[model samples]
Target: MSDDGVRWLDEDQQHHWRALVMGTTLLFDRLDNDLSREHGISLAEYEILVRLSEREGRRMRMAQLADSMAHSRSRVTHTVGRLEKSGLVERIKSPEDGRGVVCAMTEQGWELLVAMAPTHVRGVRDNLVDLADPADFAAVGRVFDAVADHLVAAHPEMEIRGH
Candidate 1:
């Protein structure tokens, strides 16, 4: 700790931290651009589609979807609205309860997802996965898992496990 009681990162730590930031920014931009150019979808929208596909019946409640993605409800709503406009997804009243809304993937959405899966996976592998040794990539996963767990612990409402 310094005299003012601040515990700043050391030189190596600073270097690594900056690298993480820059790497993530560039990697995400590249992935987003690839998807946009080839498939005409943004990475964020693709992530929503992927999440919905992983759920039972290819649907999830709006609130659950937002929580699962660590996004705000309004943001999810807006994105889903755009998807609905494109005929990719539909928002319906939740069957479990008549109150909440559920976002369901349409057949068109499923087909598009199927078609774009390869492009997305290739982009991921080309940009990130294949760049690191298996053990080093596994370590990166572990580090992010710990970071997510710690952050979510402090905000229990944002926790998405088992949802």
Candidate 2:
């Protein structure tokens, strides 16, 4: 209680931190590999499809989409460009604002999402959900929810949208 101000993690804390890092890294790696093999799409592309599908009119403003996906605007632009070439998504000038742009899911994209959802869900359950203790799983949700809240609060200018 009288040190010069660094609160370092002890052995137990270090173990938990490493466990979380390794678990998430491995889980995402497996998920990405599965998606690429089974659907010819990366996990990042699948996430973009899912988000657009969930939006009204299946569209979101470009900047809003980037913020929602935790990607930089330039990165989102590049991904959207790739998706566009794949015929899964399209970009258009926003109807309400001439200078703004929006990304929309195409019919092909929606069809792909419908076909891929089950496989992804099962993979998720097998790899993480079913393996976690029920109570610990609930705690995990709370931890991430709090972290998301803190991040969103800190960056109020990020312009995330419910869509």
Candidate 3:
């Protein structure tokens, strides 16, 4: 195709794409706000807990955690500080490396996550999962998962680790 004649989305496709973008943004916003209001933790905080819960020995190196979560190291640092203040996470000096920090989930954090898990699950079910027909939901998830994987794999220099 000539550069000037390159095809663009049809009007209908553009409109549908925009709608999907807006809806997804709003869905996330609602979930974040709802969790913050109900559980006294922001969505990011909840995610950190989930990640830590899934990690080996319920802990992760700060750098690795940040990379896995696709968060800037500074943002992870700040989030971890907040979690520490809440007695949910504890930072320990890494035994393997002098300059590295390991974030370990405290008992309190585990308990909190256990308590919040149901609520978050319900929120996800209610807001997005329940709204779609089962087959469509599975199809949509698969589509987006492939899209994200391919896009990340294409960007060799991206900071996201093991994505």
Candidate 4:
């Protein structure tokens, strides 16, 4: 412990922390830029689309989508609004809960995803997957999974879901 009674990271911890931060920043930026340049959509938009596609009837509640994406509800609303304007998604009343809103992928959106999937997969492989050992990637996934679980447990109201 230091004078402040703080337990600082040891050398190995410092190295891993720095690597994780830098790697995540560079990797996400690269993926976002690549998606924007090639598909006219940001990585965030692509994630929304993927989440919608994964759901039954290609739709999910706005709040649920926001949670799944680890984005704020307002941010998801804005992003969805942009997607709605682009004819990629539609906002509709939730059938289960009339007052709630649901976001559904449009046919055009599905088509767009189909067209862009290959490029996005290739970009992912090029930027991340191909660079890491399979075991290391699996370990990374487990690490984040545990982190998410801990955080959600600590703050249940601020729910976070894996996409």
Candidate 5:
């Protein structure tokens, strides 16, 4: 503890922390920009589509989608609204429940996702994956898994795991 009675990062810890922050920021920006430039869709929108595609029927309740993405319902709704306008996805009353709405990807959305997946994957490879050794990349995954586990345990009500 320092004079202020607060534990602080040492010089090496500070360096690594800053690198993590900057690297993630730049990496996400680059990935988002790549998707936006080539596919006319933001990374967030693409991610929503991906989540739906992986579901049993390519559909998910709006609330579940929001929870899976760790985004607010309103934010997800707003993005879905834009996607709906673009004819990429549709919102309908859930079949199991008349009250909850479900977001389903349209055929057009699936086609778009199939086409643009390569671009996103290439960006990830070029920007990050290929830059690291295999072992180091695996270590990164382990680090994040630990971080995610800690955070999820700290906030069990968030229900942000296992989509």
Candidate 6:
């Protein structure tokens, strides 16, 4: 390594970071896997539904949706198409922009979200929230906020929504 005075991660910090990442990843893996198996929906599909359900008229512009979901335009397009086929979403021309498209949650999609929200919440609490103490959980929230801010500052052109 270059003799730059920049110090590497301390052993404790490295171990802590690795454990945090691996543990969270494994938790999400199990949650998503079980969710998909039981509910016939993947985590991505659930997130899309949640986004649409929370939007005005359960609708949002394609670009905004992509931003909210942290997905590329093409990936969002493909996923939206699949959701549309499953009768969980609908796509239409944007009223605000002539050349743009929008994604809206359908009646079936709302029903699905309503059905799954409770189970999903339980899975989240069980896998992550309940496992962390209050102080640690608060710290985790702050960490995510800082990370998101850093990312936004680094990539001003990329639309990334935390809310």
Compared with the true structure, what per-residue lDDT tens digits does model 6 show for residues 47-68?
Answer: 8898888777999888888877
lDDT of each: 0.89, 0.87, 0.86, 0.88, 0.90, 0.83
C-alpha RMSD values across all candidates: 2.4, 2.9, 3.6, 3.0, 2.7, 3.1
Clash-forming residue pairs, model 1: none
Clashes in each model (backbone N, CA, C under 3 Å)? 0, 0, 0, 0, 0, 0
Give lDDT: candidate 1, residue 51: 91
Question: Where does candidate 5 have its weakest 10-residue lDDT segment?
Answer: 154-163
Q: Considering every candidate listed, which one attains the maximal TM-score? A: 1
TM for candidate 2 is 0.91
| lDDT score for residue 132 of model 1 | 96
lDDT of 4 by residue, 1-163 (tens): 9999999999999999999899999989988888899889988999999988887899999998988777899999999999999999999999986999999999999999898888789888998888999998899878877887777654332333433
Per-residue CA lDDT of model 3 for 1-163, tens digit only, reads 4589978888898998998899889988988988888889998999999989987789989988887677889999999999999999999999887688999999999999998998889989998999999998999877876776686665422333334
lDDT (10s digit) by residue, model 2, range 82-113: 89999999999999977899999999999998
Per-residue lDDT of model 5, residues 37-102, tens digit only: 999999999999998998877899998888777789999999999999999999999899699999
| Clashing residue pairs found in predicted model 6 | none
- Identify the runs in model 6 with alpha carbons over 4 angstroms from their true place: 1-6, 154-163
Candidate 5 matches the true fold with a TM-score of: 0.92
Question: What 10-residue stretch in candidate 2 is worst by lDDT?
Answer: 154-163
Scored by lDDT, model 5 comes in at: 0.90
**Displacement of the residue 42 alpha carbon in candidate 5, Å:** 0.3
Candidate 3 worst ten-residue window by lDDT:
154-163
36-77, model 1: which lDDT tens digit per residue?
Answer: 999899898998999999878999999888887889999999
